[model samples]
Target: MGDLEIVKRAIAGDDESFLLVMQVNKEGLYRTAFAFLRNEHDALEAMQEVIYRAYKNMHKVKEPSYVKTWLTRIMMNYCQDQLKKKKRFTINETLNEISIDDGTVQLELQEALKKLSEQEQQLVYMKYFQDTKIKDIAVMENIPEGTVKSRLHKILKTLRQHLTEKGEMDHV
Candidate 1:
């Protein structure tokens, strides 16, 4: 069945249809959750919560085609709330303890990503990590296409500069 059909069925209170929707989008949902939580257990818990919330609020989704984006936005909001709670419970005594030469290129890139604003981080993830198109990202983010492109360009430039200054990327 098409995604729209499945979403319509799910919203109409078909349990199997909702499960199908969850089954189809599980990987994408998990990836987004993991990217934020960075722990397998926490990511799994987040996914469960996202699924429950999606099921409960499935009727609030306006467009069937936008179901994926709607779920993603919910996951992002949930992750952000979890992150805030985590920060409150955790202590960061080694904020300055990271050494430039201590990790691989991927690790350095991850560190640089953490320095970006939440919106920038989400843009980078959607554009690069998830390979989402600019148009799709704009729709998902509820912004104009030109704005998405501009923000992505600026984010890439900032990432490159940050990596280069940290000696993580070779100047070209």
Candidate 2:
């Protein structure tokens, strides 16, 4: 079965097809959850919650072809909400404490990503981290495709500047 057929079946309440959908998308979903939550435990928790949410609301899916995007958007929103609650309870950590100059590119990139607004961060995650297509991102975000492209270009520039300013990377 193809993606659309499988998604349609899943939406139509086929348990096996739903499981297949979850199985196929698990890794990518986990990575997206981890990116936002910043730890394995929280990522796993977020994954479970998102799975529950998606399963409970499967019938709300309007476009079977965009089922993956819909799931991802759920994960993103859930993570964002969790982060908000976490921030409300925790003391704010300074940049020096949150960022480490450990010579790892990934860590540096993550630190730079933190400088972006939540919406900007989501755009980056959808476009780069999840490797979602621009048109798909536009649809998920309910924006024009041209707007998505412009935002991504601006986000990349901001990230590059942030890295350079922090001495994490040389000017390109």
Q: Which predicted model would earn the best lDDT?
A: 2
Task: Report residue 17 deviation for candidate 1 (angstroms).
Answer: 1.1
**Local accuracy of candidate 1 as per-residue lDDT tens digits, 21-131:** 999889999999988787688889999999999989988877788777678778878987887787898876223334456557866687788788888887787777777
lDDT of 1 at 155: 91
* Clashing pairs in model 2, backbone N/Cα/C closer than 3 A: none
lDDT of candidates 1 onward, in order:
0.82, 0.85
Clashing pairs in 1: none
Which residues of candidate 1, in runs, are more than 4 Å off? Answer: 92-103, 168-172
lDDT of 2 by residue, 80-103 (tens): 899889878877643344345545
lDDT of 1 at 27: 92
Backbone clash total, candidate 2: 0
